[model samples]
Target: MTALTTREQIVTTADRLFYENGYEHTSFADIAAAVNISRGNFYYHFKAKDEILTAVIAARLAHTKTMIEGWEREAPNPEARIRRFMHMMIANRAAIKRYGCPVGTLVTEMAKLDHVAREDANKLFGLFRAWLGTQFRALGCGADADRLAMHLLARSQGVATLANAFGDDRFIRREVALMEEWLTAAVAHATPRPDNRRRQH
Candidate 1:
């Protein structure tokens, strides 16, 4: 195995700590200890704990984006894409049920703690939401595409929270199934009619 670079060490340690311990609970010292580095060396890579957390958040978002791309590629239509999104969310049911959505979890817990961190977290979420909205639009999901995008995110977070609270994967799977049903109905209803009118029959 290639020896880890300093930047890699810092980020890998931060990611592990952020996941194992809550984002709020993990400290720079914890990260340093994890990597067997001095606090000063940690500071060389990250000026503050918030900086490390921001890096961790960015890495996590990138992983999630890759997952979304995989779903988007395989899903043939808006409705199917929506169902695939539900399945993706449920794929992490057990882990999300245990620790919650990583981005959602960190943002909810730490966004308000610092200005820079909050802005970084907000941008991450904006990118995620926009990606979904754009996919819905590309698939010709109708006028309510933006709303559906938001609803999908909101419902996924709710399902994760419920799963975490109950310490059970059942609720996570159930909510994802419910969201799939809701998406199918919504997308079918929203598909433009032959007359090109917004009114439903």
Candidate 2:
């Protein structure tokens, strides 16, 4: 694989630091050191911390869009796509156990700082919400799609939070299994039952 460009390297390093350490705590020098670049090079690429923050958020948004779209293509149906999303936690259980959800932690930190880029950071969740909502809609959720999307998102965030707090792989697996069951129940409920009576409409 090709090495990341300097600017890309800075954003990549900053993204990890911002998640592992929190935006407020990760210094410009820290990112520079991670990328093996000088402070002058860093400043050349980014005039201020907020600029780096914007780049990080933008990178995250782009990557997340690609990821969900890939899931949409890989899975045969909406239910499968949604399951792929829930399975993500298990796929990255170790990271979630160590640092919590990256999106959750970074967005929460940005909000606490009242940083100007908070909304940009938050678009990560928004992207997932919208994608999940589309999947729910395809599952016949109709008017309730967004609500179901938010419901699953909220529950997953809670799982990530607790998983980090407890650092338990078993907990993550158990919660994910429960989420799958929830999805099955939701789909069943959304699917219109066949009726024996003639059309009322």
Candidate 3:
């Protein structure tokens, strides 16, 4: 595999540090040390911490978009695609247990800090919200798709938070199973509009 460029290395290190340590807590010195680069070199890549944050958020957004598209290609249908999302809690249980959801934790930290990049950070959640909404719309939720998406997102975030707090893998498993069941019921009971039905058929 190709090596990451110095700029990429800096952003990548910052992303992990910000997720593992709160954004306000991670310093340029910390990221520089993690990347094994001099602080002067770090300044060349990122003049300020906020700049690094913007790059990190952008990287996350791009990675998330790619992941969602991969899920669409891999899953057979909307229900299955949505299930893959719900199953992410189980898939990343170790990380969630260690640090909570990356997006959730970052947003919470930014909000508390009253940081300028709060909106940019929140776009991470918006990406999931929009993708989940698309999946629900395909499953015939109509105008309720975004609401359903938010509900599922909220549930996942809550589970991640509690799982991190308690370090409980069993809780993660149970929650993931419950989400799958919820998705199945939602898909079964949904009544698509006539136009939506025609489109599906």
CA error at residue 57 for candidate 3, angstroms:
0.4
Could you give the candidate ranking by TM-score, starting with the highest? Answer: 3, 2, 1
lDDT of 3 by residue, 46-164 (tens): 88988999999999999999898788777877788888898888889999999999999999988998988999989999999998898888778989999999999999999999999
* Model 3 regions lying over 4 Å from their true place: 1-4, 192-201
| Lowest-sum lDDT 10-residue window in model 1 | 192-201
Itemize residue pairs with steric clashes in candidate 1.
Answer: none
Q: How accurate is candidate 2 locally (lDDT)?
A: 0.88
Order the candidates by lDDT, highest first: 3, 2, 1
Q: TM per model?
A: 0.81, 0.92, 0.92
User: Per-residue alpha-carbon lDDT of model 1 for 26-121, expressed as tens digits?
Assistant: 887777888887777667778877677777777777876777676656665545656776786677776787787776777776655664677667
Cα error, candidate 3, residue 7 (Å):
0.7
- Cα misplacement distance, residue 180 of candidate 3 (Å): 0.6
lDDT per residue for candidate 2 within 147-189, as digits (tens), equals: 9999999999999999999999999999999999999999998
- Please identify which of the two predictions, 1 or 3, would achieve the higher TM-score against the true structure: 3
